[model samples]
Target chain A: MADAYESLTDHEDDARWAYGTGFSDPLAGVDTTVPSGIDHEDLAAYCLMLGDDALIMSHRLQQWVTRAPETEDELAIANIALDLLGQARLLLSRAAFVSGSGDEDSLAYLRPASQFRNVNLAARADADFAHLVARLLMFSSWRLALFDRLTGAADPVLSAIAAKGVKELTYHRDYAAQWVLRLGDGTEISRGRMRAAVGDLLGGSLVDELFAVHEVEERLAGVAVSPGGVKEEVLSVWGQVMRAATLAEGVGTTAPAGGRPPPGPPPPPPGGGGHDCAGGAFARAGSAFPRAGWA
Target chain B: MTSAAASTAATVAAGVADPEMPMLTLGDLGILRGVDEEPGRVIVTITPTYSGCPAMQTIRDDLTVALRAAGYREVEVRTVLTPAWTTDWITADGHDKLAAAGISPPGPAPRRAAGPVPLTLVPRASAISCPRCGSPETETITPFSATACRSLHRCTVCLEPFEHVKEI
Candidate 1:
């Protein structure tokens, strides 16, 4: 509306919001001039990895905008998408600072596909309804675990983002877990498809475990984070969710190797394949549906 | 940076707390990021808690009226999409407000999340202890609050039901 007006001068000179004054630098409590004793580049890159994952996932989730199976589901999906978008914004901003480049909007809209560092899981489009549930359940479990660890990161900004993310991830996990249980325990058709979906998660390259924090972790020693290390804890909780819901436990109980450093980038995490249009990963698996035909 | 203007403006802001979580003012929620006055205009900048919070419009409208009622002419409010707001922004006072409102605020905003405490889970603080009874025995009957500000929680110890301000 302001742009449609006669001149740029007609619009208010202030960049601040007129109707929504919610983002008043919530980090006012901390000395945000710079994170204390942390490598900005590594922190920024780490943030990008997490941010891009959330951004892509949010983009992918937006496909369900009006096509959700039910009205409640539509709201739920939008809610989840918004949550992801929120994470993306925070992470992207953090990354922009680290990289000394553009801010969130510039990075989100300008970056090409390959430039994005989100694991394949986030980039993968929405699959069939059942597959979407599987991907969400798996991805949420993994990310929730990662964010859970990031809440203790050495960087104040990253810690702040992670602290906020814990709430959102908890919701995402709960929502996806509920869907998995419903589909797994519902009708015969639902049950069968759910089984296949769960089975697909077993060995999709992400089977071994993954950790991209090598540079960051090594630098900060105790400050950096590794999603790969918490694989067991995450899987254990995820397994319980599945078992409690009566789904066929495709994964066995993993022993708790708590506090061990994660191995090298082990494949991508779950959700890295099934709907990957970029890589040839699941090209042959489910031609039953086109690549995210939701549109 | 007029002290008189800021004091009056802050009072107007005092009327504007988070719509979803009424216990904390927008200032307390850390969502009411910054306020600026130029010529005859007042600009209030906000960051949405989530992209599609159903009450965003309500919050927007309330900000407008709150500023106008506070006696600011040509008031404007805008929502910033970047630097997403987080639970860590919830101030210590905000936590107290949530607790007073019967919602257990998030545990201390993780200081060093890279190696945070393991039992990490931050919900809406729905598992809040009852303000009346101080028991960690509460249940959320409805996720969405009646006023888009408070959820209905029933406490077991006091056998009393109350409204808990939903945490952002």
Candidate 2:
């Protein structure tokens, strides 16, 4: 450890994982040159959209730490959080590389809430273990499907990142699915809690936010997979898991129609279910996990 | 000026132990891809074990430091992502070292299939032997542990908890 004076002169130590700064450039050594036909701006934006989702969701999951019911389960959730954090770092670094702008740190910490591209669900607080698993199930299902398709994206870097992510996301989805089943099909009280969690988290136009295609996705045709493209696949897995858990497929309410973001940039209006609303500020404010409260 | 310099640099770089698992060298772990020497500079290409493996920076720093100590003034450690790393890359000696250290080495990695990953409620049962007792009666306590590439398990025979290098 460096003293205050030494710390000022030697910033290298600041980058250590514990210090939160000096992560080796996640994309270092990997060729980041934008392919001939792809637009750098569009590629950057697309990366953020996915990166923010992972970053925000990872932060949310980290809140579970010691709060998890079991020691092993706590480790599992923390592992999942780390996996998503790694993915977020890669994607954000990719974005910074192509955009000719700030680096991963700047993009993550400097951006305003309105500028954050994650779906709202990623940032929402979970009520309990059931809600956490329910959200994880939905989030991982969509992301896993999207990442599986992204393995073949036109951009080499994106393709590589997605291919690696597929393996990690598989474990994440499996963990969530297992928990959902355990709670939803167990004793009546457990079943009721699981069902209520699904209804509260997955019900109401919230999920539609995941499928709504944004302009950045529209612009980056081959380079990006539209969220809408993976909708059916994500929904299928969700339905399968829900039914097997003995929970209602829809859990009661369907996503309200007519809330889809209007195409073109400037991002969806704030009211847009998932992608809009709380930005980085909302996430930052919530990051101070009250340990006492959890205990 | 000679190819021998590149091989020497490679030797030095490869000899550096993984910060997390000192029992294994980067070469044994299959992360040290290659070493190219030119004039006064050496370039080392390596791959990460996992996407979020926090040890990447330390590995990079260690490689640079090792190469520099071996008389190279300029060293560059490059990370490659394609041909994503798998436990299968761990060398024979690496596995032996892990077992000797009481950490069960990984089995064959699960082969990935095309299309969306099929969701399963139960972990696929794998044949893991006790590193301490060599009993094939080990069960997974959880699929995750202190790091992304390892899982927690307990040997029913010896009743000892151990970390297994996960099959990616």
Candidate 3:
């Protein structure tokens, strides 16, 4: 072993895994040209929708660092958050390229809550461990289903991003599913909490909007994978996981009270009534985890 | 430039070592896709081992600096995400280097079986052998590790902790 280790010590000082230390452009060689005929605005909006989802979801996951039930779980959640952050960077960069807007940082930190196009599920305040698991299960399942089809997108960058995401999201869904199963079947209190969290999320329409196809999505037809196209598949997978977890399948089946946003309306700017739909701000304040940079 | 000059440029770029796993070169890890010399400029294309790999920037800079020091006028490093990088891409030499460094190399990429969703489970202990003791008595310490591409493991025989390159 000593001899073998000695042979492998050729370049020991290089810290290859450090983040952003010697940073360079991730999209260095890739062509960012907007394909002919596709509306740049539509493409930009679509990328923002996806990017915001990942960014907000990453923030929510970051809340779990150092607070997870186990040390391993803490690392796992952080890893998942980092994965989403990577996806957000790529997608946001793509959005910036298409829209000719400011870069990813401008879109992520500069924009306010109301301007975000992510589904309300991701932006919700941190909840109990059960609620977090339930939300992750729903979000990862849906996103994975969507990404599976997106690997074939007409846009090469989108296709590449999706291809990378499909693998990460697969692990995310499975991780969440295992936790849901354990909690749902573990103890009386744990089971009840898991069930209630699932009900509140599904009943609240936090995930329904994800299935509602946007006009920008429709306009990009061939280039964008339709959310509606994957809804049935996502639902079916969710149903399976619920059954496996012994949780109720159709706890909340009501249509969301609001109608879908009309097509061609300029995307909503950051700031509005929809920002605090579920008392998310209050929950954030009440949580044990320190909320510093996130707010 | 002649074909011989281009080959030399490729060879120089391939020698740039991975920042994290210093034992392996970008070429050994199968990340160095190509190095082309055009007049006074050199373009190096590489694919990341994992989507969130932080070493990419360092690798890019290393390539630029190494080539510039070797008489190249301009060096451009490019990252390509398509044909997603996999552990299977790691060259045979990379496997030896990882093993020599007391880290277990990866097995085959996980098979994508026919299903609505692929099952992601913890890395199986049976598939990996201890790099330190060369013992098969190994167990997964955690599915998460210091980097996205690796997982923590313990060798029951050697009683030492090590990281295994995760199969994507």
Candidate 4:
């Protein structure tokens, strides 16, 4: 058997052993023609929205690498982060290909925070493990539902990406859901923390933004999934999981009145209106296809 | 080029082992799609196991090296995305190879129905047996493991920890 680890040290191109060291095109050699009737600009913008979400959320998960409570948890979080990062690379590459803009690196790193099109939930720092799992449970469930529908997207590349994502997201959503269950039912202290985490997220306006309809989603029709459409099914699944874990009912389905809102939304994208997903100023306030990133 | 030349290139490409799971060849792993030969150039097609699979680059490099050493002037590795890869593609021989390496081979890939995927709070019971003791009484230690494609598990009878290739 090849000593895979040992061989890495002796390999001539040892510098390229780790991920991110050598940046080859993730979608190299695949036919990237935009499907007929799909506006390339709209498609590129849509890719940024989804790609930015995965990229930013992946960053959030990566923060847990060395700090997770156990070695197993660290591995799990790191793997999940890697999956999201992989999805981010593909989506960002597609966006760049369609937009005639910079490559994935420039789109991911060169842009300022205000230019990122991710939702507020992805950008927030996890207060603790409970908060992390709570956010993960919601994020994975929502993304899984969206990707499930995207398998039939009008764009073949998007459809292919979503098809592959469905399998991985299945594992991700289940991982977070199981953690919520364990933490929510473990001990008095653990249950309190889990409940508080769920409450803070659900009671805030950021959760509502996940379900809001964005203009790009409206224009893309069959090619994109409106977050609003999947909200019901996602909530239903979350409700079942929360109930089993003995958390409060009706928490994440909706937010309470006078709840805390995120920061204000950035100015609309060029040629777009004032229909940003986040109503107020949030660290990341752009809608699904907000033009702030482009500006 | 003659079919004989293409056959030789295919044999070389097929023998390249996976970087992570060295026991399985690229063919056994089901990532190698096709091998075509021209006068002085050969084109090889492969599909990634995952979008973010880090091993893809290494796999490409390994295939190119193996083919070039076999007297090919040039080698081109292409990737395909349609009909995304599934663990079900692992050949019958691949399953035996994984078992021999102390890793549990995946069972049949789950066939999904049309519409929304149902959410389950707990893991669905899978028919995975221990590779070492051949005991069926094994439980998953964690769904995520050393690699994106595997899960950590422990056997109750033999009490040995092993990795199981996930059924995607």
Best by DockQ: 4
**DockQ-based CAPRI category assigned to the predicted complex of candidate 4:** medium
**Model 4, residue B144: what's the lDDT?**
87
Query: Which candidate model has the greater DockQ, 1 or 2?
Result: 2
Off by over 4 Å in 2: A1-21, A249-295
Pairwise TM-score winner, candidates 1 and 4: 4
Per-residue lDDT for A168-198 in model 4, tens only? 8888888898999998878877776677678
Two-chain complex of model 1, DockQ on C-alpha atoms against the true structure: 0.15
Name model 4 segments beyond 4 Å from true: A1-21, A250-295
lDDT of 1 by residue, A140-257 (tens): 7788777777766767667767766776676677667777777877776666656655555553543332433345445665556665687777778667767765774543232212
For B8-55, candidate 2 gives per-residue lDDT tens digits of 888898899998889999988988877889777998999888788888
Classified by CAPRI criteria, candidate 1 counts as incorrect
lDDT string for model 2 (A187-212, tens) is 77667667666767655445877887
**Among these predicted structures, which one has the highest TM-score?**
4
Q: What are the runs in model 3 whose C-alpha is more than 4 Å off?
A: A1-23, A249-295, B113-115, B120-126, B156-159
Q: Lowest lDDT 10-mer window, candidate 4 chain B?
A: B118-127
Assess candidate 1 and give its TM-score to the true structure: 0.63
Candidate order by lDDT, decreasing, is: 4, 2, 3, 1
**Stretches of model 1 off by over 4 angstroms after superposition:** A1-31, A207-217, A249-295, B1-7, B16-168
DockQ of all candidates, in order?
Answer: 0.15, 0.61, 0.37, 0.62
Looking at model 3, residue A97 earns an lDDT score of 85
| Candidate 4 collision pairs | A263-A280, A263-A281, A263-A282, A264-A280, A264-A281, A264-A282, A269-A291
